[model samples]
Target: MTISNHASVPETIALPPKEFSRTLYAYVVWGGLALALLWSWAPAEMDRVTYLFSDSGNMVEYASGFLTPNFHDWDYYVQEMILTVQIALWGTVLSIFFGIPFAILSSSNVAPIWIVQPVRRLMDACRAINELVFAVLFVVAVGLGPFAGVMALFVHNLGIIAKLFSEAVEAIDPYPVEGIRATGASKLQEIIYGIIPQVAPLWISFSLYRFETNVRSATVLGVVGAGGIGQILFESIRGFYYGETAAILIIVVITVTVVDLLSQQLRKLAI
Candidate 1:
């Protein structure tokens, strides 16, 4: 009798054993201990010693007097606000102009290591100094005005925008750039033809975000005598003109909210 030929069957390989439950338990234990340690450090006695919430009536009184808000000084608020808007706009434009080139030069794929690393380090160093610190420094240097505020926003934002733009460049897909290079395109041409199109949306989005942030920052720059709505707000609060402070706060809150909403809509349209 002849037997039919058949191929030998392959054995199934076992999957490595998993310790999912054990790993989950470890995470839970770590989280609980961390929370417990935080809670223990913040003693209940510390809260009582501080007058933070000692008298609820004091807070209620302040709120009642100030929360109503007096917009009778609307004209002054509007003028300072216009100056604040100007500072933010100028700052954002300067940031975008300087930042894009720095980002390109600092990117590894775009620039050689010798060039890229130095530019990156410089940008990081610039960004390490806080915007408010720069504002204070510039205010001192320029003798206090909107120009000081503008310069503060310009330097700080130049660094920040550069970092963000470089990150965007690094995160891009390499295929398009490769394809362009394959066509005998130079490095700059490859970037201009292939990478820029993909990165433009993200770059614009970051710029808008910086613009909104600059607006808020420009407001406070005045408090240091750089000149903006912050100076008005600070003086009013110092003199115990609580109603005036409330009105200024209302104006600022409304303006910022509008900018935020507009930016959101623009981003949506962009995407």
Candidate 2:
């Protein structure tokens, strides 16, 4: 045991080899994306890239008309803008009312597979169709008014709200729900006490966000005779009253900005 002036060397551990499957998967994903773009390029008119530069004068002349907005009918514009907001309010409220039950039914953690599958498929159908298409149909049924717009938004947003809320429900901490069940609480009671409390903040935030989106969508619904400022805006555009179009667009921008700000503040409070 005499001092052996030697230090023991640590073993060199080898790292596992990188998997070839991951690299192949990455290449497949990128190749698929490239193929999609290539396939659509001609149909999408990718060859017209030089047209913007060549036709710059026409764009300038068209855009110049919007530089001076005519607010002569400012009162009417404000009134229609308010009506648009009202449409969004009613639509969002109705969606929230109907979406709650659908959300619960669609949630995998809350409902049985038999119920969840059908409810989710229904929601998928609702979500797949655009609100504009729904607006067109409702206009036919309701005879062209804000009511049609309300129904359109309500139907489309119901699907969206349910999807958002179900996702929130699925992600909830299961401990509280388990505790409620342990206390001999019924299924509905467990959901009401445990699930609702956990997801309330997120649900409120989602609803507010949808309300903001609905406001913007409501503005366009008027084009389909669903009523609101979008009808007037479309008229101005069709009539080539560029000044009036500019004024209406300005009002829309301001209203959307204000709604966005208010919703953001409310979301902060909710969280």
Best TM-score among the predictions, by candidate number: 2
Q: How many clashes in each candidate?
A: 0, 0
lDDT of 1 by residue, 1-271 (tens): 4363585645897888879999899999999999987797657555554565777788788788797777888998989998998989898899889888899999887889999999989998879987778889998898888888888898899999999999999899999889999999987799899988989899989988999999999889888888789899899989988889999988898889999999989998987
- RMSD versus native structure for model 2: 3.4
Q: Which ranges of candidate 1 are over 4 A from the true structure?
A: 1-50
Q: How high a TM-score does candidate 1 get?
A: 0.83
What TM-score does candidate 2 get on C-alpha atoms?
0.93
Residue 81 displacement (Å), model 1: 1.0
Candidate 1 colliding pairs = none
C-alpha local distance difference test of each model: 0.88, 0.96
Report residue 271 deviation for candidate 2 (angstroms): 1.3
The residue ranges of model 2 lying beyond 4 angstroms of the native Cα positions read 1-17
Candidate 1 yields a Cα-based lDDT of: 0.88
